[model samples]
Target: MNLKNYPRPFYAINQFCQPQCTELAGRSFYFDMDGGYDYELKVLTGDTCEWNIAGEEPKKAVYECLKGDDTTYMFDFDIVGAEPRQNFFFCIDLEQSLVTLVRCYIGRNPKFPLLVASEYDFGAIRVEGQPLPKKRHCLTGEMMGTTVEWHWNITMFTQHNYYSPAYYRITWPQYSSAEGSISPNFEVLAASDEISQYVKIKDKMYLYCLTEEMMERELGDSSPFRSNNMIFLQNYDRMYHVGRTFGSIMMDGKVVPCRTMFGSFGNPVRLEYNWLTAENPFTV
Candidate 1:
C-alpha cells in the first residue's frame, strides 16, 4: 500500500489480516444523522465515490476503503470541492445496517484554528425496504485499563494502555505480552498522558480516537513526530483495527496535511483495576 507519507514519526501500523476493500464496490448506501444531516454514498467498482448530502452540495471523489472485519467496511474520502478542505470517514456495518461518520477539518476553526478539528455523528443506514437499525455505535468503557501493543512499521512499534476512560498512555516497548504476543524488547518514551475515547460497535468491535495535541504542544516544532489525529475501529474478535488520521504540522515554515488510513493487529493484555486510575476522563 503506497499511501502518501504522513507527518514524520508516525507510520502507525497495518494488520496482517485486513486489506483494501473490494467487497463494498458498487454498493450504495443512505444514512441519516442526528441533526437533520444525511448522505447518499455510492461506491463505484474501483472504490471511487460520488457522495451527496441530502440538502447540501455534492462531490465526486475517489475514496479509500478497507475491509476490517467480516461485515464492517471502513470508508473515507476527501470532500472534493469544499473550501478549507474536509474529509469524511465512515464505518459501515452491513450486519447491523448502522453508519458512523467522522468529518475532519483542516485549519478552519475560529478558535484554536490550527488544530485538525472533527465532528462525529451516528445514525441508521436505510436499505430499500429493510427497517433501520436502532443500535448505533455509542461511547464505551470496556477497553479501560486494557493494554494492547499494536504492530506498525518495524521502527514504529508501540503499545497503548487505556489506563482510564479519558486518558491513555502510549509506550514503545514492542508488545503487550499477552498469550499470543511476544514479550517487550525495547522501550520508547512513555507517551505524555493523552486523551482517548471509545465507542462500542458490536460485541467485540469498537471505534477509538486518539489525538496528540497535548504532546504536540510540549514537543513544539522541534519534534519529528508532531501532529496527530487518529480514529479507528478496533475489531477484537479478529484482533485487528482499521482507521484514519487527519492532522497537520508545521513543516519548514508551512502547514502540511498529514492524513492517512491504516490497519494493524493488537495484542490485548488484561490487567487488574488497581494498576490504573479510577478518575473520570479529562478531569486531571
Candidate 2:
C-alpha cells in the first residue's frame, strides 16, 4: 500500500462487530489520523484506490472508506470471528520509523466509543483484546422528559433473582445441542467502562446511571425469568459479597445521580477498581 494520498484528518477509526458464529468470512479494519500523512486525510475509497489487507501473503482485497459527505465516511465489509473460544488481532504501522504498530481486536460483540483525534493529540489509541458477547439485559430510565434505556450484561441469576455485576462474563449459546450448550467469551468488563453504579437504600440494592434506549423489542419468552426489557438487581443482602457500592452509567456526559428508593436522598460517587490496594492477579 502507498502512503501519500488522501486528505489529512486529525484522526481516523475503523469499527466493526465481532462474529457471533463460525464459518464467517470478512476482514477487520481500522484507520489512522494525525499519527501521520500530510493531507487532511478525509477518507479512503475504491475510487481513490483500493485497500489491501497488509498481512495476507497475496494482498487480498478489503473494503473501501467512502466519503459520505464533507463530515463523514463509511465502509462495508464482513469480519469473521474465530471459532467461538478464540480471538484475532490485526495491526498496522502508524509511524514507520518508530517501529510501533497499532492493533485492533477481532472477536464477538465488542462495544467501543467514538473518538475525536485532536483530543488525543499526542497519545495513541489501541484495543488490548476482544470483548466477549454479552447476554443483553434491559435497564430503563428517564431523561429529558423521555424514557431512556440501555442493557446490562447479565452476570449471575437465580430462581428468585437476577444479577448484573459491575463486571462479568458473556456466553454464546450453541445451536446444535438439544439442551442448548453455552461457552464463555472470557472477556471481563470493568465498572468504569460499563458505566455502571450501585446504590443501597432502605437496605435494598438498586443500580442507577444506566444507558437508555429509544425503543423496545421482544427477544424471547422461553427463559425462567421474563425476557421483557426489564431486569431485577438482586437485593443487597442477597449478594453482599459482590460489593458495598454500586456501579452507574453516565448521562449526557455526567454521572447519573443515585437516589434512595423514595427519591429523597441521592448518593453520587465514581465507582472504580482499586488495583493498588486490591489483589494483584494480572499486570498490564
Scored by TM-score, the top model is: 1
Off by over 4 Å in 1: 1-17, 108-111, 174-191, 250-253, 270-283
Q: What tens-digit string does per-residue lDDT give for candidate 2 at 66-134?
A: 221221122222123322221111112222210112121222223212110011111122323743222
Best by lDDT: 1
How much does candidate 1 score in TM-score? Answer: 0.80
Error of 1 at 98 (Å): 0.4
Q: Please give each candidate's TM-score.
A: 0.80, 0.19
Which portions of model 2 show Cα errors greater than 4 Å? 1-33, 38-61, 64-182, 185-280
lDDT of 1 by residue, 197-221 (tens): 7878889888888766565555545
